[model samples]
Target chain A: MIRAHGYAAQNAKSPLVPFTFERRDPGDHDVVIEILYCGICHSDIHQVRNEWGNSTYPMVPGHEIVGRVSARGKGVTKFREGDLVGVGCFVDSCRECGSCKEGEEQFCTGGATFTYNGTERDGKTPTFGGYSSVLVTNEDYVLRVPEGLDLAAVAPLLCAGITTYSPLRRWKASQGQRVGVVGLGGLGHMGVKFAASFGCEVTVISTSARKEADARRLGASHFLVSTDPSAMAKAMGSFDFILDTVSASHDINALLGLLRRDGTLVLVGAPDKPLEIAAMGLIFGRKTIAGSLIGGIRETQEMLDYCGEKGIVSDVEVIPMQQVDAAYDRTVKGDVRYRFSIDMKSLST
Target chain B: MIRAHGYAAQNAKSPLVPFTFERRDPGDHDVVIEILYCGICHSDIHQVRNEWGNSTYPMVPGHEIVGRVSARGKGVTKFREGDLVGVGCFVDSCRECGSCKEGEEQFCTGGATFTYNGTERDGKTPTFGGYSSVLVTNEDYVLRVPEGLDLAAVAPLLCAGITTYSPLRRWKASQGQRVGVVGLGGLGHMGVKFAASFGCEVTVISTSARKEADARRLGASHFLVSTDPSAMAKAMGSFDFILDTVSASHDINALLGLLRRDGTLVLVGAPDKPLEIAAMGLIFGRKTIAGSLIGGIRETQEMLDYCGEKGIVSDVEVIPMQQVDAAYDRTVKGDVRYRFSIDMKSLST
Candidate 1:
């Protein structure tokens, strides 16, 4: 067994604190990663607080993990010592399910083994996430981090980045298309980058007019203040696609109104409350409202490659491991410019 | 001007009563049709009662009309006297819009001239629907009714049939797919027939167990009682496409769970309230909830052709024009077998 030290929440209401745990010894098909960075995701907060009602504790919650491969078991031929790799939301999923076979393991029928706050395939062993100093995972689940990108900034790509990328790709957002990214937070920022990099005319739709300059700086060609009724009315039925990234409850019908005929609004954010959608909005324009999770392994690697090629990395605020609780609060308040990545070296200090 | 007589709702609170009106004489591009039958739609009730808040007084409500060409203007080359034809939800649309040019005139950017209770393109003349003795329509908006089908039964095809068929066709429902149809009304019944005729393994999902035998008689191979928890549990993640036709509000989330990964739930019914949807359901499975209005004129023609070839027609209860009020009440209580087609001859009587 490998000794692992990380932050954990003893219960739903408790703040995370230092804790010690063990990971299984590297199996024949497994590789051990010395964690370098872990990006905090909104889901981590949801799980830690048991907001979803399915959480278990003490839970070490992190999934957007970036690290250096420290050891490889004999049968692991994919990576050797010191290779930079990433682990996203899930660590393992049943390989035989249709979704798994189709490379969409996020929808695995047997239930995916979440990186944290979830059980392994055996249904008895608890899994710890990448707030830890090390992780043991099968080579198949490991993604090769492309060269020449800031690793800390790349950590959130596993979650926020892929969550936005998968939908853009699926919806065929491309050159000459008008794309709108709703919200200007972690997920929306990446959406703008991806859509802009794809040669689309990107527009940032937000409640705050303050984000206009920042959105333009992030490669958006237009910014529409969603709170402005006249602006919204002028932009109605204009977008080919709208990537909605707001996690807070908002008016989805108004967003649906922004789509042209046959246009789509893809929801990447999981709002706690159910959305109120008028069928007429969709029916009149023949519009669609779809949702997507983080991409599959192959797609995640593709996203990383695309980001590397486009020089696109998350706009992140790096912090020490001790500041995660504060960062979580800040994230809830939308104070962070984008994402927060915990530098794992802070654990040693 | 041509004299016409039929049932009209004098005001929102009133029932249909005999009313006289006049239609413009056939112009160069027009074909005048003597009405044979008109199918009652649930929307007719909504419009008559001002449920949508857009109703006009003295409204002649019906769109599903099948009749014979009574006269053709000089420039009307598509039809001659005695030719069987049908007119659906709309009578005219701006021909220059993208939707109109693509034959999706129903979504005309300049606003489609609905068969009834809508203003014509000139923006002042009120258009009447098929409940009357005769209708004058442009050749472009008329459809050829194929030979050998019951014209009265085919009346419902103009509205209810096209409403359901468009979504099924758009979703690419075909052989080897599992299709589920919700409810057993005018729209749901058509959805089952279309999906089943498309060589799919069809399942009828309904709240009533009594619908099982009727659903099978409509060519469905499987019937699942939606009210049965165990049945719903067993059928979860089972369908590739579910054509939801329940206009009255119900649990959309539960129906969304019945689709497999990448599956879609298409809504043709317009529930009065906005549907409540959990984003996680759509995100985790890559599922979609989409709305479709009636198909384009081209597609509607194709649907009619397909129905003719397959000998498919709505299972309808024929009634006199005076029984429309009773039919509406029965339709509301789910007492009708599928649809109510009023014989226009009774209007003259």
Candidate 2:
């Protein structure tokens, strides 16, 4: 075991604090990563506070991990020392399942081993996430970070990026298609960027007109104020696809009304409460509402390469490791401009 | 004007009574049909009682219409005198919108002219449905009744049959695919027959185990009582597509859980109230919830042709026109074998 130090929440009710732990030494086909920047995901707050009712403590909550290959076992042919890489929401999965065999490990039938607050493949070892100093993961689960992108800005791509990209690619949101991005936070911002990069007519739909300028700056050609009835009515049956990224409960029926015939609405952010959907809204026009999780390892690597080619990176605010608690509070309040990528080296600052 | 006689609902609280009305004479594009059989739909009750909140007084409520072409205008080349024909839900549409252009007149932008309780394109001429003795319809909206099937059993195909068949083909339910049919009513029975004919592994999910033998007789290879928790738990994540034919509000989340990754659940039924859906249910497996109305006219014709080839017709209980009230009561109580096709000739009996 290798001695490690990082921040952790001892329990659901407590704030995260500096803690010491041990990570397993590199096994064959395992690579040890020196954590560089980790993005604070909304799910991190949800898990750390036991909002989802399944938190294991001494939980080091982070999944949007960006790091450097510090060490590799002899059998690790994928990554060399100092190669930049990423570990998203999961560390490993049962490779024998249909999902894993199809390269969609995120939906592995045998259950995926999550990055933190989750047990490893051995079922006895607790996995610590990238909020820590280092992480040792199987080489197959690691994604290669493409060159010429801000490493800090690339952190949220592990979660928000793939969460948005997977559904967009899966649904075939292509050129000349009208796409709506609901919410203006972490996931929505990336949805706008990607939809725009894909040559789609991207519209940012939000509750406030104040976000209009920022939405336009983020590549949105149109800004729809959802609170305005006339605006919503005017946009009804117009969009080909809508990416709903708002984690808070909202009128999904109203959003469903916005889709044209046979259009789809994909949800990336999940609210705890059940959403009320009018079946007529879907039935009359043959509309669809679907949900997507983060991308698989192969898809994640593809997303990274695509981002590198398109020069697309999340708009992130860099924060020190000590400011994680504050970042979590702001993230809950929807006060952040976009995402907050934690500088792991700031443990000494 | 052509004279017509049928049972009509004068108001929401009243039962059907004998009433006389008139229909337009056959125009250049119109065919005059002498009604033979009309299916009693669940929606017929919903509309007569104003449960859908859009009923017009003295309304003749039925769309599952089968008839013989008694006369045709000079320009009507599609049908000849004495030809068997049928008309489904709509008589005409704007013929201009993308939906109309694509042959999906059911979703016409200007609204399709519903067979009953709706206005024609002029927006003032009220329309009546198939409970009447005679109906005048354009050739485009009329379907050819393929020869060699029980004519009475073909009535429900105009509405219930096409409603179920549309979504199955739209979702590409094919050979060896596992398809689940929820509720064993008018729509569900056809779903089972079609899915079975398509060489799919068909499972009929019903609230009552009493329907099992009937379900299998209707072509279901398996019957799983949805009320049984153990049976449901064992079938988790097992289906590729589930045709939800239940109009009553049910545990949509539970049904969503039955889908495998990338699986879809299509709803053809519309319960009045909003449905509660857990985003987690759809997100975890990347499942989909979609709504599909009845098929396009072209597709409805295709379904009719396919049924003709397969020797398929709905299992229907033929009832006299005077028994419509009792049929409606029995339909609400789930007492019918499948559908109730009203014998229009019984109006004189």
On TM-score, the candidate that comes out on top is 2
lDDT of 1 by residue, B1-349 (tens): 9999999999999889999999999999999999999999999999999998999989999999999999999999888899999999999999999999999999999999999999999998998888899999999999999989999999999999999999998889999799999998999999999999999999999999988889999989999988899999999999999999988999999999999888999888888899999998898888899999998899999999999899999999999999999999998898998999999999878
CA lDDT of each candidate? Answer: 0.93, 0.94
lDDT for A274 (candidate 1): 97
lDDT of 2 at A33: 94
Worst 10-residue lDDT window for candidate 2 chain A reads A340-349
Stretches of candidate 1 off by over 4 Å are none
Residue B103 of model 2 has an lDDT of 96
For model 1, which pairs clash? none
Interface RMSD of 1: 0.6
